[model samples]
Target: METKKTDKILLFKGIKLLIFAALSLFMGPTLMTMALSDKENSLYIPLLIVACLICAMAVFLIFKGIKIIMSSMFDKK
Candidate 1:
């Protein structure tokens, strides 16, 4: 019973991570382009920072999600 609960939790966590990673990956580039555009928006600097962070987090999430899935796969009952 405990193992079943843990496995379900881990699976959901992995799926969540993958979904967020995909969203961040998609959003990061678009934000970056906005940051680099010639438009004179005052929020450009902050947006640039956010874009970089998002891209970094996206990469991190992908690795972490894969790690979680692998760990769950080999976890002892």
Candidate 2:
């Protein structure tokens, strides 16, 4: 039987994605809270929009990271 080996470069890419996702996870909620607290301010709408986009990006990154990590570990060459 042949031996299986993990793809180190892809694995590292996935790790990087996870790290960015974690940062986004923290930032999204914080921005949302700020936007909510200052609803009457001119920046409120813009802040809310950005927070929603960042939150969505974080979720996408999490799933993409896991998929990349799995592919790196299990894909057959």
Candidate 2: misplaced stretches above 4 Å? none
Count clashing residue pairs in model 1: 0
What are the models' TM-scores?
A: 0.82, 0.98
Q: Backbone clashes in each candidate structure, one number apiece?
A: 0, 0
lDDT of 1 at 77: 65
Residue 71 in candidate 2, Cα distance off native in Å: 0.3
Please report the TM-score between candidate 1 and the true structure: 0.82
For candidate 1, the 10 contiguous residues with the lowest summed lDDT are 1-10
Off by over 4 Å in 1: 1-6
Quote the positional error of residue 59 for candidate 1 in Å.
0.8
Tell me the lDDT of candidate 2. Answer: 0.98
Error of 2 at 7 (Å): 0.4
C-alpha lDDT of candidate 1 relative to the true structure: 0.88
